[model samples]
Target: MGAPSTELQELIELLNSENPRIIQPACEYFSGLSGTVDGLNFIIAQEDIFKQLMKFCSFENSDIALLALKTITNCAQNENGTYFYMACDKQHFCTKSLFKSFENGDERIIKSSILLIENITRIEAGARHVHAFIEDSKLLESLLKIFVSNKPQYQDLSLIFGNICQVPGVRKLFLKNEGEIFNKMLPFLSHQNASCRLGAANCVKNCCFETDYHQWMLKDDSILAAILLPLAGAEELTDEENDSLPIDVQYLPSDKERESVSDIIVALVQALHKLCSTQMGRDALRKYNVYVILRELDKATIERDGNENMTFEIHNVIQILIGDDAAECDDLNKLEVPPEIEKKLTEMENA
Candidate 1:
């Protein structure tokens, strides 16, 4: 950290210029600069740089604000810088400035704002700060509005919910939404886009952390069935059903397509592991014969030498559902193996 370079100083001054022309380029320059560690440290070293950048977030011109938000998002890449952004003005970056930018009807600004907030909440300190503002403002509702509108920002909104919902209170608010967030995300388990399914699975995984929420999830057999769909590879997302598959995925030959399916399996297995923590939750899984699905998936994954982490999770969930006794059976996949035979098999193996 030598003394600030003349170029850095000039850019900082140019960012503060009154002319929109100068400001826009300044935003772009800073955006590029924020990409590197040295450049990031330069911006972080500048006094009140974030405070100055906050002014650009609401310049009445969407492009400038978008660039400004981009720079802010880039700064968010560093944990220390994120704390600095969150602390710029007692959380004004989130509360007044960024929230205003979020509502300005600019998709770029909205997306950038979502990413900035997501970065902020990456740590608990920043998460707690944003959570307080979320309780008071229409932040969560605004995110839901964007989501239900089926806008481009919906994926980012899904991720924002995943981060915010890690807070227990916000998660309950999510469950109470009119559409019932659980129901909204459940069908995505069968979505054609693999990332869509992964995002939905991660959010659902966080929701299951709350013990009280378990009943809402477990009470509906249909919910469990729909969730299992992705894991079973039961339904493929056809072009007729969903036209939104990324062009790269849609154009690739069929043989290359199952790559997406493997990612979804990892998310589903991770979610089920979280969902099956309690005895009642385990009972619900058993009622739906989810263990059968898990065993089949486990066998397939082991045979394929698939994702080791996901395969391990599938094994763990099956054990939870069928109990420690299942571990003793000759073939754990046989859900109906008798206790006597299981004991004899274990005795003979141990012998």
Candidate 2:
């Protein structure tokens, strides 16, 4: 990085100016700059400007503060930008300002703050920082309070929860206390907004990675049913099959529809696949006749959008459900894979 350009220096001066007119437009200019890779790189190189923007997050003027946050949010969208926010002594500063923004009472500020934190938590190191931040600040309780309220305005908090739960320590919070917090998040899988649904679905999928909790999640929370409900259509099933299915997914209304977003569908399918890792999970899935739901979903998906990856995952779960367990290894989760096959799996995931 080189010295800041004269033009960049002038803009920084305007941003530092106490006048609302100067600072507002300067913040807007930085907003546009921070949105692109080249422009963000420029802003990142200018430590003074970057620090100024972080300070503006708490500006007395709501407009300036919101714009500064929006700019920071844009910068945090990429890995490099997220690292910049988490680097040096600014991590605590950045996270504290974000949590404070939650109480700003301005809808735009709150949403932007959530989005900024969401982007930060996407990176592994950033997630760790946020996990620690939440733990130390005791902010998880407050966040859960907002989440369980089911307030439409704060629906985007689901995204933050989803991303943060990717951390094992943070995930344990939801898993503990008999999964009290985890159960509250399950209803959002069927939220009216696709983003909320996607977030909650991803959260569920992340929690599914813990094999020990499989039986409890399936029985106590009805988690399998919550995830599967979004994948079921109005396709008719026989009375026997319907009765065998989990109640949440049985006897669909004629007007009932499946989740339209491909990503949510994929996440739900992956969660089901994770649940199949253990014997107990497999038994529960088999008991519920989950295959019946996936069979219809597979057909409907192929007919509508023909998402090959989605159908592939659906088929993968279907195979496990219908496989002869007696002839197969008892511990599916512990099965070893050959190097070539593992490499192929990695390539497929990357593709």
Candidate 3:
């Protein structure tokens, strides 16, 4: 990057001005710049501008603070821009400002802060930082309070929870306290917002990797029902099969629809598969007649979108659900993979 242009220097000075008139337009100018690739590149190259933007997030004027946060949010949309925020000293100040925004009594500021954190936590380094921040600030409890209270329009916080839980250390936090925190997140699987549904599904799927939680999770009938309900359609089931399913998914109206998003469907299916890793989980699923739901899902998915991958996943879950009990492993996660199969998986991943 070359030296900051004379015009760019003047803009930076104006951004530091005490007058709201000068500050607002300067923040808006960079906010607009941050929206385009060339502008983002220019902004990212200039440390002074980047620092000023971070500083503006804490500005006394809500409008200027919003513009600054918007600018940072736009910049953090990609990997390079996200890494720039991670590398800067102002990143801590930016993060503190984000949490402080929650108390500023401005819905727009709070949402912008949440959006910025969501963007940042998409990367591993940022996830680690935010995870620590949540732990230290006891932010997770506060977030759950908001969520359980049915607070309107804070669905994006679920995305932040999902992103951070990808880290092993952070995931354990949810699993703590007998998974009370994790359980609170279950209802959102059927939330009206597609983003909320997707985020909740992702969190469930990621946490399911802890096979130890299978028994605890299966104890809550709602968890399995939540995972399966999205896969259930308007198709009528046999009376016996309908009675056997978890209550939430047992009866379907003629116009009942499956989840529209492919990723959410896939996550729910994968979570089901993980739940089946234990014999207890397998028994619970079998008792619920889950295979009947998957059977319909397989056909529906194939007909609706020809999503072969999702179909394959459905088949995998069905295999375990209906497999002979005598031949079942006590814990599927403990089963060793054959060398050839392991090599094939590695090759596929690398390819």
Best prediction by TM-score: 2
Q: Relative to the unseen true structure, what is the C-alpha lDDT of residue 272 in candidate 1, on a scale of 0 to 100?
A: 74
Q: Write the per-residue lDDT of candidate 3 for residues 211-311, one digit (tens) a residue.
A: 87788788867788878888899998889999999999987999998888988898899999988888888889998888999998888787665576677
Among all windows of 10 consecutive residues in model 1, the one with the lowest summed lDDT is 241-250
Model 2 RMSD vs true structure: 2.3
Error of 3 at 68 (Å): 1.2
After the best TM-score superposition of candidate 1, give how far the Cα of residue 96 lies from its true spot, in angstroms. 3.6
Model 2, which residues run further than 4 Å from truth?
1-4, 88-91, 136-138, 303-306, 325-331
The TM-scores, one per candidate, come to 0.75, 0.92, 0.86
Better of 2 and 3 by TM-score: 2
Position 17, candidate 2: lDDT: 91
The digit string of per-residue lDDT tens for model 2 on 38-112 reads 888877767788788988887888889888888888888878778888773355886888788777778778777
| TM-score: model 1 vs. ground truth | 0.75
Ranking by TM-score: 2, 3, 1
Error of 2 at 341 (Å): 0.9
| C-alpha RMSD by candidate, in order | 9.6, 2.3, 3.1
